[model samples]
Target: MADSITTIGFDADDTLWQNEQFFRSSERQFAAMLAPYFDGDDLMDRLLAVEKRNLQYYGFGIKGFTLSLVETAIEVTEGNIPASVIADILAAGREMLWHPVETLPHVTETLEGLADRYRLVLITKGDLFDQERKLAQSGLGDFFDAIEIVSDKDRSTYERIFTQHGDGPRHAVMVGNSLKSDVVPAIEAGSWGVFVPHELTWVLEHVDEPVSSSRFRRIETLRALPEVLAEISAAYSAA
Candidate 1:
């Protein structure tokens, strides 16, 4: 029998639109500002370490990002940095507000094509209001059958969404940029996953291990997804 996929979950941030570009630009500014106190490598390492440790406390979003900046600044500066420096970092974080739209070269056409063959769901994690506003403005909202703006992407979150949507693990697929947030969880839940590399994926999203399963695949662009899905469907049919 052919493997049946009824629902496809998509990540919104870097997957659908230009998200990490802003973060990358802000990170460069942050490093420049901290140049007097620390070199770029040292400052970035410190910030990455701090963010890894604080993921539980801050979860994901602007709040965590702001805290990472504050914590890193205080630690590296030995509490001697001026209040203005911290204020600037906070301002930078606040400026990260994004307007949603497609980022890939041909994202709209790809989503339009996929929507015809699969049930689509927008699964993103972030500040509720900000995410909602982006979706509303993106003009791509109509493509999704459901929108899940979550605080975290974990096993529980995936399970809950699958259950709520009446989708079985075997019949669902997740497509996104982050391996840590999107791919692993989907695989753990017995769902297929598609990884689309972005220009500015966070260090936390990196995965060291090779993807060994036939169900998990990687593509370079959103435009290539329709063909990949067709291939997957063909393979399943053959089996």
Candidate 2:
């Protein structure tokens, strides 16, 4: 609600569209396929561990995720898995390539409402081709003034974006679903962060600490955004 704020950044993936559900469904299918070799819990644990370890080496995207699935499947089966099983896992990974391509509840309306007042930017990180495909299909693309598909979200990234836009952290706000990739870094960069939790946030995006800053708040749905933004604007004016 700071009066000086004229720019807002948005995270893609789970923020504006359905992303994690695809991964979750894929994981379920993977577990079902691997049940003959190991328990569901153990298999999931190994997959999670592999994903975490690979994030450092491969960053984020379908490539790394697919590789993790392949590696975990091979590891759990102890090299005894059939070629068909491997094919099934690879198919499951490819199935995650396309999502339903619909904006979250209120996301479109909120973006339209905010467009008149703020310079909106779509800032997301992931596989370039897949991310672009989703964005192109979203129909929400036109509302944004800029679209940045980055490799990661960190302080330097935020700084670079703001500088390029001729803005500063104090006058910027970041809205998204991931506490790790969106909210924490935005707050750390001295900007406001609004968290709209999705039903299936990735386990990797989970945060250990509570978000308790005055500059940070959480909303249950995207539909609540316009009113919340209005309140922020009003408060900024009052200050």
Please name the candidate that would achieve the greatest TM-score relative to the true structure. Answer: 2
Q: In order, what lDDT does every prediction score?
A: 0.80, 0.84
lDDT of 2 at 218: 84
| Model 1 Cα lDDT, one tens digit per residue, 82-183 | 888889998888777643344566778888888877888899998787788778877889998889998788877777776677466667788899988888
Question: Clashing pairs in model 1?
Answer: none
Report the C-alpha displacement of residue 229, candidate 1, in angstroms.
1.6
Among all candidates shown, the one with the greatest lDDT: 2
Structural similarity to truth (TM-score) of each candidate:
0.89, 0.93
Name the lDDT of candidate 1: 0.80
Model 2 misplaced stretches (Cα beyond 4 Å) = 208-210
List, residue by residue over 1-239, the lDDT tens digit for candidate 2.
33578888999988898888788888889888888877546788889999999988887988789889989988887887778988998887777776558677778888998898888989999999899989989999999999899989998888888657637777888899998888888888878888988888888798943357878878888787776777777778878
Model 1 poorest 10 in a row by lDDT:
96-105
Candidates' RMSD to native: 2.3, 1.9
Look at candidate 2 and give me any clashing residue pairs: 1-232
